[model samples]
Target: MTKTIVNSWNEWDPLRHVIVGRADDCHIPPAEPALDAKVPEDSDMRGQWGRRPQDTIDRANELLDGFAALLEGRGIRVDRPTPIDHAQPATTPDFHTDSQFGCMPPRDVLLTVGSEILEATMSYRCRWFEYLNYRPLMQRYFEEDPRFRHESAPKPRLTDADYHPDYLSDKIGNAKRLEWAAAKHFVTTEEEPLFDAADVLRFGRDLVVQHGFTTNLKGIEWLRRHFPDHRVHAVNFPGDPYPIHIDATFTPLRPGLILNNPQRRLPDAQRQMFERNGWDIVDAAQPAHNSPPPLCYSSTWLSMNVLVLDPKTVCVEASEVYQMEQMDKLGMNVIPVALRDAYAFGGGLHCCTADVYREGQCEDYFP
Candidate 1:
């Protein structure tokens, strides 16, 4: 048997290996039901669909390369995915998309658990084939680690029935969106199991998932059945009008600490587990920027989407001054990384990377 290489139970263990995403051949996908619902009514990307600007792609690559190098400098092994031409359309019997989104954020495509790497059944039609970009790495892990379990979730049909027609209108204001969110009426319907890997947060024996636009109640149920050994909890942040992924909303920094977006507080009903476990859920500092970088799908709360290197060290965006100060006050060694240019491609530190190996066994943090 080969040496163990694929293993990670939680997000904050000491990092030994990781996969950082690339910004090459990224695209703004054509508007679709579930995706369009998340786009703010006035967003610049409302109707645009094409390859991203060449200059912006180049700049983003530079930052990503520098980030990989920075990880190498700290003695952490970093791997990168082979980019596929996102210009090709994804055609299936049930659906067809004109173009595909890029692999700029590996977190949305791959979920890492103890001894396993599960490819997510992403909700968007444009992202159906995104897992191809990481196939090479998966093959490598399978060959090198005898214990590595490379798994893929069941592919969702993603037909028209998968989306709720109520969210298809472009005129739905933020107030209306918030009301819908509060009522747990997300864009994705309960027709199928649909989820993005970014919607899940692993804490040893517990997997916390967000029930939002990219993930439906059925998706959470699927996760619960799939990982029978772990406690799967479905959480909702009704305050976020455009709730997508959980990284920007609820971030677990260490064993007993979590930085939650102030605007998207976890409801009291959902706080029982954490509070009972003696955890401290602190409101994250405000983002330094008023708006996200151009053509970005995520909000400025990416400021809280930090990458935890062990429990004492974290990498924060260089421009997020308030976030840095907060991390410092919380007794973290903050490493400033310049990654705002790449925000247009996908997300921040945590969003752009996926875990391969962290230096620890699965220890139940909530038990």
Candidate 2:
């Protein structure tokens, strides 16, 4: 009998198995306080809700299927989520929403640290049931991998008390939003341990968590308590007005090198650990476009949200010339994948996937 193997310590390891998301039946969730705060003031996604256009969903699935094939061609095993009906309304005792977010981006729902894949307690009311999309895969992993630890964080009761009403206002300009971010105030209060899996990045012995609109201080604390062996650090980027996940903001390409969004650089004080450990945190190149793709929730920095196939290889969006060139300059074999059209579905290469197995063990890079 073949042994069950599920292990991934950090981001840039030699990946063996992974989960690539699908865009089937994805939805543009209705307006909610947390979701509203993440959307830009003048963005096209504003006032939009319901199932996305079938044409767009088909295009996104084409890209995702092609991406999975590409990874399979590279000797990697890829598993896909069983996407549920996203148009189904999410109703809980604490709150109710017209619909749930899609399973197009599994990284936002599952956090893989070593042998454990934790299902995060997402902050958004619309995304409360998003984890259901990946339950089949998780069940398979559990049945196959005897050592795999499937854990779910404490479910957040996303009542009105969990969010700050001030962020619900559509007229809050970028200046005020920036001011609020700098003040360490976000749309979600410390009502519960609310966090999206994408907010945390695992680095062997250390975990770098983003304290932003999607994750509060309490969420970081919850992660710390959950992983007693890992040193959890809470980081905030004042430059981003609608900060959520950290993948686009801070990308670690390898053990000692990271790419930081030029617009949302990590604060100097937060740079101590990397600097002291001889790691280089360089500013990522400017995105090719000034604005994000239509109806996208992310900023232009999604250009840097690349998937590291290995330490020396990466997959980047085909149209992001500057980002592709930057990866080439950094000595990485860049695989140009067509995914810009799919960005509106969720995000780029990295966001659309989640790690399941990588060939390595936990090693303290900082110590």
Candidate 3:
């Protein structure tokens, strides 16, 4: 009999809970009493909530650990922590370690170097250019073919911020705009920015074919390399000022089932990719008046930042975001954790944490 191993958040064993590697500068400043008063309006994505750095860290850790505990409570076994050294130069071994956000397909384990970590850095070079870890994960994959290539191309030219601040809440409105403008300025600046005009036009013509967000490229590549056989789906960003990550509109709960807002248009051709694979795609409907744009805040707000505790359960921030009364109709258990500060860092639970591997799934060598 085939063992149908269900990798659900709820079924995860807390004893196996571990952080794969540590990012040097990813931690928030320790919450302090006086620092609360010093919250810069620029960085103060957290409005009204006056938690200091330590408080923020404590709160984030509480939620992270709590989620792990929830998994442990469910008898799921987690793995030991893996340490990734950030002190080493990004290119010392594989120059692309810093930007792993969307490189791989989602939820796949990679066998790179002892430092098998990889990420995509932006340049006029190859679009899918990759920076592999020092040790190299799969020598076979590397030796097999040149999936990633380097090309000599001109850097992209950026454009002024086209996204207006119309939909943001009063508190984060100005800050979000500033952030978007800053990103736009950099991308359209004299030097290499996040995007350029020609690049932007190309990306818009076909969001799936376009490449942006170097950090997310890391995640994308990881998914691709690790789960080579899995069917991957990404949404088209018809809107401007690129969404931060793929999770912006698409997140998988089970193999084929995903939770997504309807604003993201998945053409029939793309939808068929899942259906043809014997996967069932479920759409988490949006509110009658609710729409996603200007960075699809729902991607972040809906606790899309949260991660799956199990195939049927998820852990999210205990805030208005997850308070959607209509979610119960979807038939999944929601666990809420306090993550206000973490959410401010442009990520929440899922964003901050990376799922290294799923338990009980052994991948055999195909090639």
Whole-structure CA lDDT of model 2: 0.92
Q: Clash number for model 3?
A: 53
lDDT of 1 by residue, 110-172 (tens): 999999999999999999999999999999999888899999999999999999999999998
> What global local distance difference test value does model 1 have?
0.94
Taking all chains together, the TM-score of candidate 3 against the true structure is 0.48
lDDT of 3 by residue, 276-349 (tens): 76655555544322332221122333444446655567665666343333345556577766554444333455
- List clashing residue pairs in candidate 1: none
Each candidate structure's TM-score, on Cα atoms with residue i matched to residue i, is: 0.98, 0.98, 0.48
| Model 1 weakest 10-residue run by lDDT | 1-10
Model 3, position 207, has a per-residue lDDT of: 22
lDDT-better candidate, 1 vs 2: 1
Q: In model 1, how large is the Cα lDDT of residue 79?
A: 92
lDDT of 2 by residue, 1-367 (tens): 3444789999999988999999999999999999999998999998988898999999989999999999999989998999888888999887889998899799999999999999999998888888898899889889999999999999999999999999989999989999999999999999889899999998999999999999999999999999999999999999999999999999999989999998898999999999999999999988899998888998889999999989999999998999999989999999999998889988989999999999999999999
